[model samples]
Target: MAQMARSPRQLGTLIQNARLNRDLTQQALASMVGTGQKTVSRIEAGHPGTKLDTLFGILAALDLDLQLGPRNKGEPDLTEIF
Candidate 1:
């Protein structure tokens, strides 16, 4: 299912769900992502301090990706490179 995450907490929930769905524990995921279990725990708890690189790494590890689209025609996808 495609879940819409409009907040950091919502995104955290989605990531946690994906991890669980893959039968992965926070420790396992942390090991795979070269981070600590506490970091994973904090991430799942929606800690606002989580870094973008860390988030992206975890997402990639979970086989998930992010897409940023514009809400209007004049908006551009900033995620793309020139």
Candidate 2:
């Protein structure tokens, strides 16, 4: 997928969509990711201050990965040059 800037809520929406597309319920996903249904619901609701590890777990469950990149033109390219 093309990288686009998105807020946490938007990210959550994307994750929710992916989960639905995979035909997984919130509870099922939570079980797969070793979290609670309420935690998944909170994330889908875009609750602020969610732990980074929790987000990573959700992404992993959705078969997705997070990639950090420069947010501005002048930002340094931290990734190793190929």
Candidate 3:
């Protein structure tokens, strides 16, 4: 099955769902991460101005981690290069 690409809104929705599933309010999460409720709300609304640190804080607060990897396949043999 092909994985569907998620937009910012979709990503935000996923985060929001997780937050709600954990019975957390925006204010609660914000307080946990030492940020303002408005920051959390804006992030949940897919605002582009959300800082990377803020997002990381929220993710950490929610016990989440972000992973990044190559999207395409490419492998090289060292012997072949030499």
Candidate 4:
């Protein structure tokens, strides 16, 4: 399923959910992406300073794709999915 993330927080929530769905811990994901668990935690918490490479690495590890499109007006909150 595709999700619309209007902000870093929303994007982080989606990443967190995907990680949980795969039954992978933050540390496990960090290791897979050659980073520290703290970094993973930060990313999951929507740290605005997250680098593009790191984000892409995490997405790849989670087998996720990032697509860009015209933003929808008044889109529902991403958290509503849970």
Candidate 5:
């Protein structure tokens, strides 16, 4: 079941869902990722300030992995915008 995240909020929602589905508490996941509960909470809250490394760490702790693929049809090129 691969989930596509089109935005930071969507990514956070997916992470939160994954965490809850695994029956993992914020503190527990934070511990696994060598972070704090508040950090996990902020990531789950879709805080833009959250670092990419932090997000990856959380994903690793949740047993999730990242994959790169072609953009969906009609998707704008983010490279041009960024």
Candidate 6:
């Protein structure tokens, strides 16, 4: 299933779900990405300071691909509603 993440929190949730589905602990995933468990935790918590390289590394480690596309205008985004 394709998940749309328009916010850091949503993106973190997606990453967390992927990691859980793979049965990988934060530490294990961090080890795969050459980062610390705290880094994984922060990423999962949607910390805005996270680097793009680190985010990409985590996505790669979890076999997840980041896709970019034009935002759909038909459906209102959460930010717009709030």
Best by TM-score: 6
lDDT by residue (tens digit), candidate 5, 1-82 = 8987766677789999999999999999999999899998888877788878988999988989988788877876665433
Q: How many residue pairs clash in each candidate?
A: 0, 0, 0, 0, 0, 0
The sequence of per-residue lDDT tens digits that candidate 6 reaches over residues 25-60 is: 999999999999999999898888998999999999
Error of 3 at 25 (Å): 0.6
Candidate 4's residue-wise lDDT over 2-79, tens digit each?
A: 987777878999999999999999999999999999999988888899989999999999999999997566766556
lDDT of 5 at 34: 90
Ranking by lDDT: 6, 4, 5, 1, 2, 3
Candidate 1 residue runs with Cα over 4 Å from true position: 71-82
List candidate 2 segments past 4 Å from native: 3-5, 72-82
Q: What is the C-alpha lDDT of each candidate?
A: 0.85, 0.80, 0.75, 0.90, 0.86, 0.91
User: Which candidate do you rate higher for lDDT, 2 or 4?
Assistant: 4
Q: Evaluate model 6: give its TM-score.
A: 0.90
Candidate 5: residue 22 Cα off by (Å): 1.0
Of the candidates shown, which would achieve the greatest lDDT relative to the real structure?
Answer: 6
Weakest 10 consecutive residues of candidate 3 by summed lDDT: 1-10
> How does model 3 score by TM-score?
0.74
Arrange candidates, best TM-score first.
6, 4, 5, 1, 2, 3
Model 3 segments more than 4 A misplaced: 1-5, 72-82
In candidate 6 the C-alpha lDDT for residue 52 amounts to: 91
What's the lDDT for candidate 1?
0.85
Instruction: List where candidate 4 sits over 4 angstroms from the true fold.
Output: 74-82
- Provide TM-scores for the models: 0.80, 0.78, 0.74, 0.87, 0.83, 0.90
TM-score, cand. 2 vs. native = 0.78
In model 2, the clashing pairs are none
